[model samples]
Target: MVVLRMTKKLPWLLVFMFGTVTASEFRSPSVAEKGPLRYVFDADKPGSDSSLTMWTAYTSKSANKAFINHGTSVSELTKLFFNESEFRLARAFPNCLVEQAGELYSPLLRTTKFKTRAKYTECSCIMGARWSCPVFEDKGRFVIRATVPLRRVEIERTDQSGVRGGAELQDVLTVQPVAKPSTDTGVTAKQSVAIRADFAEALQQSNHKNPALDFTGKIKVGGHEICTFGSEDTADQNQTDATKCLAVVGVDEGLIPHVPSVTSNVAVVSDKKASGSSYSAVPAAGGGGSGLSYFSDTSGTYANLAEDASKTVADRKTDQDTKARMWLIPFRGNDATQIEGVDTGGTMDNLRILSEQVTENPREWLADRGYKFETTSDVGLGDIDIDVGYEHLLNEKMKAEGYIGVRAPTGRGDEYWSNPYQVRRGNGQHWEARFGGTFAWQPFTWLTAKGDMYYSFALEHTEKRCAAFTGADIKNMGPQVDANVDWQYLVVRLDCNLFHPETQSLSSVFGYELLWKRKDNITFSVANMQTWLGKKYNSTTNAFATDEYALDADVAEKYTNSVGHKVRFETSLRATDYCEMFIGGSYTFAGKNLPREQDIHAGINLTY
Candidate 1:
């Protein structure tokens, strides 16, 4: 048995010794005899690691394919980043701003087979693609590093009368990190291209530490919020109730104002209070002013001021690019059902403007009181307001401003509703004066607070007349002289900034409007207008086309005790140094049988 085992193992041992001797005695082939070889490294593979050596791949075919794939992915990702960057964003995709690879990329790749746990600016299956990347700093300088694969490079092989050059591929892979001056914003093209060039050169140099991971991208911070409320009126006087609900959201998201219409549209505020100053409102003839006019709208529906005429009063346009925030509400059929029922929303395509009618000279901007200014509103049909105010910087930590504004009856008011209940006052032109001030305090970058208060007084109307329309006399109705009425409102709001940064912020705003009113009942018949138009009272589409409706009764509704409470939360993202995007929503609890009004708006503001 021992002899047989030794004989069986003897042949295996002899074969192993012969193979070892042949390998040891054999001389290495020369470079001319054998082809050069290299292992390709890619971290995109399933098991790729931070260690460059571990990422190395065998087989030239796989390496070549990966090289081209990496190049293509990098190119495509660069293009995506360019589009999302602040400089050339023609269309914004905030929803696609940033996301994880596994969720957002698989579909784009058209296959569920590929997914990654890596985070990316947008989703894609190709590996090593990035944008809006976090800028890494070494000391005070921005460290820009790029790892690029090179097929070949040409350098001068000889300097003769006739130029000569030689091309060569890298024999080894090295790494080098480049440094650049940091901008307040993003990476420069020179930094990107130059660092990329360094990647190629470093690969030819002796092996060194792997270059810092390269990320060419940007960052943006933004969010949105919505809220809602409603109420009816009852008189409650001498109430010093300060219900404090402090919140901080953001700064004024400035916007552009709408241009005025060419039609004869007039705006006015209404004051039917028995205890306050009584003011009359008048509709202009192919004209415009601001006021309040009311009549018994028996049907309880009314027209939209925007449908009949223009609804913007750009009091904030400056000589520079108009940094103005304008409210754009679309109005369809006139009526509370159409306006507040929330079904008749249109677009801001008919953005119109009602200027201050003040001269264009810069000197005209200054009134004896202060400079002209405007604030944003979450109200319907927006406002045609003109305010003259002075702002003073009390100190580094605080500032104060005061203004007296004349709200042109030029905005969409209560009278904008369709008839039966066309008792819409705050229509036509009844100029009202408002005294208000803003006090702002910023204790630190993370915190800020502001107090805003205003009181509006109904001034006596320049003219007073009442008109009545009966069944057939809708077109030709004479005006009758009528009398005195009064109305006013007081408002106070507090705003706080909870999170504030150069590129992002959060803020909260809460306020209340207290009303003072006592108006006689206003009654009007829709039959007369329907008869004139030769259409049924329900032919709402045509009946509201014209702005020539009037009332049959001389009384206005009494809303002695009314008030509105509102809260708004807003957030902003600074996509770039000059561009900011913001969104917010608010619900107003209005008083005196008024419906709760809600508003939500979002926009991007740009500065040159």
Candidate 2:
């Protein structure tokens, strides 16, 4: 929602006065000191022409375009002044609803009625910007009177030079309080509170037999009233056999808040499970045979037999059954962040197949099959690639996960080719399978330590061009480890990446990161990170070189190093319930051999 506040141009103040005075008292010579001429009316005095005078008039021209100036004219004066007497009359009486030539001109009366003389002693004056007027008051009366400045007419004028001028005529309007009808005050007898309960067995038995309506009338004990409200139904579960009942107990006015009554009903069912089976059993692994041999025999025979036999017989007998059931209860406050309930039937079969094959070819296997995957790629490939990973958890603490992902070229190249090469696309498909576990140790209430480990194997297959350049099928096996310690408002974390490169020869590379967080009324975090380090045997040069040994290593080595220290700081101010302002900066300090670069970023964050 957006809120726009109108600008105020004038500082108008109000003073209120209350007194008993007749019409003649207002017209007396001594009262003239209040300024301007005064007029009063008792029941709309006959033949009275209370037309006001002694006021300066100015013409205003209004522009028809422009939203801010839509209602007022440009020629209108920025400020207006009303004499004390004129202001008083405008404040004390209802605005005149004058009609001329069948045209109605009312001073925008705010309310429908005017107050009696005895109650009309207080008055207030208001002055403000267009549409938003200010209110000034005389505080002597029991009730207050508010006056508004109203626009009467709009005009537009174009000068000789073709410049446009607009104006509007405004008048002061008065508002008064009116009386309303009194409410009826009829006494009511006191009622009583009722209580009832149905045990589990009773509820079960009621399902077998229909019970009729049962109620307990109001009863009083020791000046306290009680009423029991209930009902019971006995019939077949059908529209014709259904029953609905309700009861209400009226209580005395004084006891209304203290005593309350209740009504309830019970329904009986002729057929316990009228809708048929309430529970169903789905075999996690569906095939004709049983035991692990069923899958082993099929897989082995398929691989050994002819291609036709494998496709016709082995494929037909493979278990590919996947089904899910959801149970809904009409209750609030259920944990929906993750799926709950145990896999009570048995250990699902072919889980490893899902972890391997599905993760390996996710797009072809799970695409359009209701599974979601996400991934990040190419920290080293000079592009960003994201893939969805199929994930599931086991035993609450252990997580089984896998993903089938593809990384294509980005930018101008992305539009024409899938990968880096123009002649041959660099479309790389990668499959990752990993198992992770979390452990927590709480030595004290204010301090705790936690750790996690993930060991994964990634099989990456790129197009022929990429295979020729990389000299391998592009498969990598890696283990990731992360641990953290928290002491109330302070937290420290460590993460490491260790992987064996997937190339012609086995090579190892490792990266590490450390982060620290401190929290008070606000939050702050700092992190130091580095990555991609390894020693490689340069066959062409017949010498040992680091992973940074590119063909243009000499140029890069002149001013910058391959490895650098990345430092980042993030800070946020907790402004309110739903908003926060955060600022963060990162600097990359090149190794003793490289040039330096830094980056800065900040933005507001809102949570609903």
Candidate 3:
């Protein structure tokens, strides 16, 4: 799992995020000093046209009820919203018939009636009938309606009337406004609010208010207050400007990297059992000087191997960051500054066989026993890279971003790494500059596509390395291997995003990338640490050169290429509007000596 703060750390500020959005202004409401508006119903009002009155029953029932004998008591003044009260209520109370003497009645009216099991309570023993009446205006007081009492109740005990009756009641109430004799009330004219606030003042206040529903701070009486206020245009403009900044910069480290310094520049040779003592002879038969020592290699096998692995790791990390930046551009829309990241640390691990026979024939005892010093290596390498970029929305259909960054010299330039198995780790101590462009298109609500192209140019680091041995001993060394080294990198990735499950900002991506690199003036001989003597000061080369080795630069070319594909699934969490988290995992398949890998990453980002 990879976790990162959305914001970069500043020299004086230790913040995990730098973005901020002004939610709302805490303004105190001013005491009203003006009169309020007067509103009166007009003929154009909705209900004033017909004023039809309808009586409908609301019902509530249990899914299943216990059965009771006939003539069970039922309560009046009960109702239900819908017939389907947990059970198949529709089947129980089918559509009602509405007609007037063979003439179809108005569909808007509930001009029908029916009786069903008890509702308003879960008790099964009780039952009641629903009575409904339509309010169709026939322009007369006479109406066609059911005779059933509007409210009736059956009780366990009978009243003096002795008709098995309990109670029959119908109640109604009316409200009358107070008369306007001189004044309706004593305090109607004091401390009144002015509904007709100046439009300019309202607009100015809305710029500071969180105008989500009330875009205008002024109160309006247009039959109803407009919750989707008319001042939204100005409020939106202000919100947009609030997030605009002159520049945005980021410095990052690790995708929560777990890579260890598995490989060091130091090499250890032991003289244990099965040692190459048979072949390990003293210079001139103990003619003094048979000690072992280590020399630096900027183009040696282990260094190059570890360096290549590190490059692969760094490349993948950069790709992840590119995708992250590209994905966020749409989320941020046009309210963004320079979206950039300067992240460091990546992981590199490789395995190399350490067989004695692979480089040199061991001693007679070791050869007879078929014994050799062999071990597999697990090495780690890392580096830091920076990107400062800007993105622009070309149109609603497309967006583009460009960046120029540097791969800083963050790695141990020399052979400075932890050697776990006498293996090498630190790549060349070098730095490079990168230029890249990203393009994205959203063709549909569920699909998005992205493309990226990048090029890197590295500054060469020249250092002498142990070369091909001219003999088996520490003497009789060959000419110095005056090797030169340089490198350049080119890569491109194509990514497509697929819709995620109900999550609003979630997606899955499928991508393919091709990486090409050129390492000029670099090649190594078939010399192992055990087979070669140590390095000595070479006056001819004016650099450190081995006493018994010469490097070969003609066996290889300066260019190498690799291709890889990745499938990643990422999703946005339902977090606060200002804070968002994205997490994903990808599986990579590569070719041409490149290792396959799996990566899990997540990061939190904030937009002001």
Instruction: Enumerate clash totals for all models, in the order shown.
Output: 71, 35, 14
**Number of clashes found in candidate 2:** 35
Candidate 2 runs further than 4 Å off: 1-458, 463-564, 590-597
lDDT score at residue 56, model 2, on the 0-100 scale: 12
Please tell me which predicted candidate would have the highest lDDT against the true structure. 3
RMSD of every candidate to native, in Å, equals 41.3, 43.1, 47.7
Ranking by TM-score: 3, 1, 2
| Model 1 misplaced stretches (Cα beyond 4 Å) | 1-383, 411-418, 421-426, 462-486, 500-555, 589-593
- Report the C-alpha lDDT of model 1 over 538-599, residue by residue, as the tens digit: 23332222223334432222222244444554555545544445554444433432223343
> Residue 171 deviation, candidate 1, in Å?
99
Select the stronger candidate by TM-score from 1 and 3. 3
- The TM-score, computed over Cα atoms with residue i paired to residue i, of candidate 3 is 0.33
The list of candidate 3 runs beyond 4 A from truth reads: 1-382, 413-427, 463-483, 500-503, 523-550, 555-561, 565-569, 606-608
lDDT of each: 0.24, 0.19, 0.26
How would the candidate models be sorted by lDDT, starting from the highest?
Answer: 3, 1, 2
Report how far residue 280 has shifted in candidate 2, in Å.
94
